[model samples]
Target chain A: MRHARIIFDGRELDIDIDANDRITTSEGEVLDVALDSDQITWLPPVKEPGTIFALGINYADHATELAFEPPKEPLIFIKHANTLTGHKQVSYRPDGIEYQHYECELVAVIGKSGKNIKREDALDYVAGYTVCNDFAIRDYLENYYRPNLRVKSRDSLLPMGPWIVDTADIPNANALKLTTTVNGKLTQDGSTKDMIFDVPFVIEYLSKVMTLNPGDMICTGTPHGIVDCQPGDTIVCTIEDICSLETRMVSEQEYYGDKY
Target chain B: MTANTLVNSKLVCVALNDKAQLAALDATFNEAPYKKPPTQPVLYYKPRNTWSVDGAEVEWAKDFDGNDVAEMVVGASLGVVIGKETCRVSAEDALNYVAGYTIVGDFSLPEASYYRPDIKGKCLDTSAPVGPEIVAADKIANPDALTVTISVNGELKSTFELGNMERSVAELISIISRIMTLQAGEIIAVGFAGDRVAVAKGDKVEASIEGVGTLTNTLGGA
Candidate 1:
């Protein structure tokens, strides 16, 4: 069955969805739960995922455009849980950075837990899938700083969700379209096919090191064409079968003000 | 005394006082829970200077020395400790690398970080006070199911579940190990779920978890 968490009118429910992961609830049903839009908090569909990892400089096209060769292996980084925000959330603008951008990519959600799974059965471990925008504070790209607390893990930096789709629904997660729009303008237009290493490879590569939990999320690298944005920009990122994540670019003052 | 425990469950305890307040949180893993270790295992540092126990009493002052101030952190989460030597471990293999979890209070003026540009915004002596006790890893079944709430002087500031986090403890360990080496006694704090709030002097902060225990600290004035 299609699964979704939606806030309609003033109710929230884990309802069945179509391919879009949207609310399939018929009107006037009065969702079993009600929450103010402002008060409603959305979580990534996968339960307590073990990790939130990302691939760095993974797309060969992105690698070539920047004049850098792709790493011999996947270059991974962590975006602390503090950086996560679901659809219709706000992503903070760092205090000192002038540049920031959104990278849309397919997020592989692990289903079963196993280590050293062969590439042939890698797809067997995938539970479902979701979408995540690696909302980055691109300010430190020039500086040689650790991605730990700097490049990533800023306040509410990642915008994920709408929902998680069973991996089976996506015949080829690697062949989907990943797009990003900011302030209603096209900012990033890319494809998973351009990935130097596809999802199965990522899973096979990652499993050798750690056992991915059912809810854990891994972002396949974003493709080329990343555009910069500032506060007051609204970004909407969508992956083909997965859901879309919408967020507002907020400044420090706005983030720390009445909202915080 | 030996106790029965599960492999996927990791229990990290922090002890630092007469009445050590303990909290149990999950670590990602030592090995590549997802892929493989990036390179030389990293035993990152988040000294006691950066430690902050949730549910500890916090007080306000202009600065640690006395300046103009707005508010202070009450029952809250401040920082996390990264283990030094763990490698390619999974959520199931997490329990062994823990030193334990502790309860501490952190009070650093935003300016305190400016004084020392070398380190990040954290790392101040007394910046962290941990422990009420250490809970064995096997003791807690699901870290995600546990409740983490912060109260400032009897008022509830935030209430969230470890499950609320985007990433779980096991996954964090797996992912972290992939990037850097994790050593025994290292810790990774699953970030808090809500925004932090301030508490005044004489306030009491309490942090509690199901199956684990509670930690209480009085605002001593920062």
Candidate 2:
């Protein structure tokens, strides 16, 4: 099942999407809405996600490219609510900064709450998967508190979800193909298999520390092929059949740089 | 709303934001991974599971390895509760966004380094014990000048003033709001100064902030 949260008739509602890509109300009433309907707006599929737990260097190739050794344990960081943006939104790249990039990742949405969950029981806790473009402004990077808020938690930096594909439909998650395209050019291409830490283990590791609550999103780290992205550049991220999240980059001036 | 009916909101903790505390961490973990004193707010989330009210029992969650429950480091802190939608708020106007204040017993397991946060060490369920009451922001004459003290099993451990914080309430709110909109009811746990003592199971812990009120919790489970 694919669920998309959208604004229709001036009110936010969760609509069901058929396998044929048709949108309908949860009550099965057909909605005359398209994913690109100008009359409607998009909201993140998982609204009010408590905390977005993101991984750093979870892909070996990306790790080697950054000249860092693979960490034995997950390098996790928190991305607060302010960073979340829905599909078709614009992420801001501040002026005079260099090396801002888009990272295509698979995000796991937790359904049930559990703590100290076993690795084998991990998948059962996952409600579904969605696509995330964890945009970063690398110019703010400091070795101190690596992957700090300045780098990862900028407003609108994280664009996630058109819909969340139920876990039951994605039985072989490790085999799913993930990719990112910039203005129609393929940039990041990889598979879930390339993850240094796979989904279940990641959940198991997280649950060992904090209780995974419903609506919490665990953004599995991004893959390699990170390149600079700029204003007006449209980026689309996909996790095979799970979902596709498209976002555009706009300069701070274009958004709010001039306001202050 | 009465105290029993008030909803528990998100808890955001400022990490290593005290000048003396950061210097201590800088001296101890002097290595390539970390730069001396973070230039930005190093923050962590203590999710809702960690939220417990005053006088509650903070369970020592059975460790993952099934070993004896590890001792917890009880960090006492002052929390600024947001009362309004704050977005890109200026430091000069940050205090107006605060609705009230409370005392928080920010508990965690000991970790060696601050480079990467250990979820196991900091985010366990029932780890953060907050409040006896939320003193309205305006009621407190000077939020920055108050003293916070901690005691374990009725013995005083440490006491520190909130004025020692490297970043004031307005500055933290201003910097954080620039990154993300801080909604009403959410809390920002200001960094703790002085020392955090290792508390064992069966020990009673009490954290008190002058004017805000005291939060007491007993560690449970062997």
Candidate 3:
């Protein structure tokens, strides 16, 4: 089963998508809207999502690409709710900055609350999996908390989900293929198997530091191929057997329109 | 500023806002990794799991091997509660968005480096104990001039002035809001100053701001 939340006809709704791509409300009433319809605005699959934990250089190859050594422990950072936007959304590329890139990642949504969770039982706490584009502006990067909020937590920088696919649906989650395309050109390709700290390990590691609650999401880090994105670029991120997330990059001027 | 009011709020905190801290690290800031002093506000997030109410008993941090760690640092500071959705606000208008002020006891395991997000040292469960009550923003004459004091076991351990901050409260809100929209009910924990005192298990810690009430908590035995 796949779950989604959307705003249609000025009404917010909880919906489910079938294997055949049929859309229905939680009450089983069929919705006549297509996933790509301009009539409906998509919200992030999880409503009022909790703390978002993002990994930094969780892939060994990605660490090598950046000329850094693989960390002995997980390099985790927290992103706030303001950074989130849903599929088919517009994200702003700030003016006078260089090297804004998109990172394709798999996001795991926590289903159960647990503290000091063991690695073996970590999967039991996961409700579902979705996809996110962890966008960053390298120009804002500083060594003090290296992927700081200025670089990563800008408004609408993270584009998440068409919807969430149940954990049961992806039996081999660690083996899925993740890819990203910019304006129809494939820019990144990798497998979850390459993650240095896999899903179960991260869940265990985080639970030790603090409680893991329902609606919390962990965005596992991206792979190596990251290319600079520009205004007017359409980036699509997809995880095999999960979902595709689309984002259109626009200038800050276009997004704020003289408001800023 | 009841715990219920902050149940859904996100606690955003700043680092190196204390002028004394920057003065101490002035030479190091010019070296490797940092390369130069921070040009913008350095921010971090304290998630919901770390939230605890005043008078709560917080557990001591444990090592990777599961043994109790000796002491946790006390990050005593003022907390600004946002009353409205704010984005791209100006310094002069920043205070209008504040609903009230309270004390925040940002407890953490002692760690030396500021180069990475210290999730292990700072984000322990029940680490942030906030508020006995909130004093309305209008009641406080000047937020920056307030004096902050830290006490442990009834002994006054440290005292500092909020005016020593590199960035004023209004400036912090204005700069942060420019990058991200701060929702109503969210909090901004203005950073602590100078050398912070550490507390051991069974120790009672109290942090008080001049206008805002004091927040007290105890470290439970491991």
Candidate 4:
């Protein structure tokens, strides 16, 4: 079942989409929620899931090109709830922006809960997958001592989901393609096939550090060729058949420089 | 943290269940990750009334009974409950420091947080829902690699990673032991992720670690 919690006439309702059914409203309320089409305020696909995490440099080719040794382990970071927004939300391209980038990744939502999960059985715990545009304020911070707060945990930095697509339907997850466009101009176009560390590896590696839970999100890293955008620019991320999460660039009032 | 990078940050011993007092701190602290908190763990003054009991039921305060101020968070965290007092143990010989585990959700004054309000936020009588049991360290193969999840009213709210964390549990004990000595019955929180949401009246929260059982509580607002 493709499960989602959506806003229908302003009420949050639990919904399940079937192979034949795509759109519907809240229980007993005769309403039509536009699912596959252009219309939505994009709230985080799930409400109140435990911690959401992001990985860096999981792709080998991209890592090497950027002069980073393919890490012996996962390079992990956290994204607070304040950073998450749903499809079609306005993503701020802060004032005096040096460079900001969109990382289109296949986010794995944990279905089962476990700690110290072994690599072999990692796939069994994944509930499903969703297309995530892990936007980053690249070069915003002075240096990468650790992904500092303001640059990483900004408002609406992450715009995810048109809707989650279940795991069963996606047989070859690692081989799928991810594309990014800012203002309809193609910038990042890459294949998950290029990833050095695969999905099961990330799950197994991360499980050692923290427990995975139902509704928790694991955002795989972004690909190279990331470019810049400005206000009035719309960034669209497509992962064929999975989702196409879009965000309109907006100017901000106080563009806080990286002090975090 | 390296040599001479240590000092004490004044912390207010605010009660978990008080609201008005906590709202005052929001304008001050910026939520920063404290992996290896300058050698000393995330230690400060614990509320004098803090206690631990298994399967014990909690009662509510009257002022919060009929109003919306009684909800509190279970301070579910990992800290090595010390076995014996040892001063200046080497980084290699720290294993003699075996004691056991304790789950905590004591009173916290995190105002401006979604689930954490003031007096009702951290101070509910039974808000510190602790234990059904405890685990020894020699038994735990890897202490720092564990992840913890917290859920409120059946919704997951906080996620934590112990591995890549800025500091490790053993490192915390070692760092803290350098200045102050480790004593028995003194529990230390390894540290927690800075993000927390709100919980309201009649809401139930469960904090679960992999090996440890769930720490459950029901909020009765002030």
Q: Which candidate leads the pack in lDDT?
A: 3
DockQ of 2: 0.54
Query: What TM-score applies to chain A of candidate 4?
Result: 0.88
Worst 10 residues of 3 chain A by lDDT: A251-260
Per-residue lDDT of candidate 3, residues A108-182 (tens digit): 999989988999999999999999999989999988887888988889999999899999999978899999999
Ranking by lDDT: 3, 2, 4, 1
What TM value does the first chain of each candidate achieve?
0.85, 0.96, 0.97, 0.88
Q: Write the per-residue lDDT of candidate 4 for residues A1-260, one digit (tens) a residue.
A: 45566665666776667666565444644335556544445567766554566777778766876687887766666554556777887777656668877788888888887756777888898888887777767654422223443455566677778677788888878887888887778888888888767778878766643346676788888777677777778999987657788887777642222311
| CAPRI grade, predicted model 3 | medium
1 versus 2: better DockQ goes to: 2
- Native contacts kept (model 1): 0.00
Give the DockQ (2 decimals) of all models.
0.03, 0.54, 0.78, 0.03
TM-score of each: 0.54, 0.94, 0.97, 0.54
lDDT of 1 by residue, A151-238 (tens): 5645567777867777788888777888888888887788888888777887776654444556567788788888777888888898
Per-residue error (Å), model 1, residue B47: 18
For model 2, the TM-score of its B chain against the native B chain is 0.92
Write one digit per residue (lDDT tens) for candidate 3, span B1-222.
234635345898888899988999989999987889999988988788888888998878887667788678887888898889888899999999999988878889875877999899888888888887778999998899998899999999988798899999999999999889898878898878768888888899989886688889998883
TM for candidate 1 is 0.54
lDDT, candidate 1, B119-214, per-residue tens? 222222233444444566656655556666777667777775655555555656665553334444445545444344556666776766655556
For model 3, name the residue pairs that clash. Answer: none
Interface RMSD of 1: 17.2
Candidate 2 residue-wise lDDT, B1-222, digit = tens: 113412244577887767788666765556656645577887777766677788888877667786656566888888888999887889999999999999878788776666775667777777887788788998987788888899988899988777888888889999988776688888888888636788998889989887788889998874
